[model samples]
Target: MFSGAQLSLYPMSDDFVGIITGALSALDPHRDHLRIETDDLSTLIVGPPEILFSAMRDLFVAAARSGTHCVLSATVSRGCPGEPDDPICTPAEGTLPVAPLDERIAKAVAAVKAAPETGQPVACQVSLYPLGVNQHMDEIEGCIAFLKASGVFDRPKNFCTKLSGDAGAVFATLQQAFTRFGAAASHVALDVTVSAHSPTRA
Candidate 1:
């Protein structure tokens, strides 16, 4: 399966360049495990879901630690037929096909519960797209059910669902929702925006 994410970081500060550059170092440990490329627009990370989410979490946390409001926008996808499979995207261990919706929802909830806290709190909105599947709505609904039970779920938004909590559980929830839905080899994508240290938060 081919899995990857294209993400951009925005730090609301005059020294945004410094903050972004310094925060990128958080991904250093994951460099060997992922194929990372950065241009003017966004950074593309290709690898297994575990390394992908962890790297994202670390990078976002590093930037947020600077005490500046930061937002991370990411489009994560897996099993897209348009993209060719790369050896680097292979997981260390193979995965089975997606299970029944109820089973998947249960497992996703369990995974989020087990996520370690990062102390850094984040608010995020996400919309999942399960493409090329006949029962896409079923998968989407199942994901929504899982999110509502994820403990981090904040509420439902206009076109997405809102989640707020420690960055750890939030990201874990996103990862689970992305992986547990749709067919194993089918295309699945997640549109996500995560904010930390926002001024408007009470």
Candidate 2:
């Protein structure tokens, strides 16, 4: 299976360039673990799920620490058909196997509870698509149940679910949503947007 994300960070300030460049350092710790490439549009990170989300959290937190509003847009996927399988995209050790819907939900909730706190808080909205599956709705609803119980869940939006909390748990929940709902080898994708230090609040 191939897993990766195409991520773009946007800082709402005149120093966007500086903020973005400085935040790139946050990816240093994860560099050896992932295949990272940057271009004019976005950065591509390919690796295990745990490392992928952690790297993203670090980068976003770094930029947000500047007290500037920052938004991260990413398209994350696993088992993509067009992509060749790479050993680097291997699943984490002891990753949960596909199980009954209820079992997966319980485990996902436990993961969120166990996530390490990163001090920085963020708000994320995401939509999951489990393609080419007859039980797609079941998978989606199962993910919804998991999110509501994740502690970071904020609310349900029109087309996606909203989550807010420490960056760690929020990203953990996102990882769970990506990995747990779909079939073990099926194509699953997530459209996610995360924000920090936004001036406008509800």
**After aligning candidate 2 to the native by TM-score, how far in Å is the CA of 115 from where it should be?**
0.7
Q: Model 2, poorest ten-residue lDDT window?
A: 89-98
Kindly list the per-residue Cα lDDT of model 2 for residues 100-160, writing each as its tens digit: 9999999999999999998998999999999878999999999999999999989999999
Q: For model 2, what is the error of residue 78's alpha carbon versus the real structure, in angstroms, after optimal superposition?
A: 0.5
Estimate the overall C-alpha local distance difference test score of candidate 2.
Answer: 0.92
TM value for model 1: 0.97
- Candidate 2 at 22: error in angstroms? 0.8
| Model 2 stretches with alpha carbons more than 4 Å out | 94-96
lDDT of 1 by residue, 82-190 (tens): 8998877776557734578888898889989999998999999999999999999998999999999999999998999999999999999998888888888788999
The segments of candidate 1 whose C-alpha lies over 4 angstroms from its true place after superposition are: none
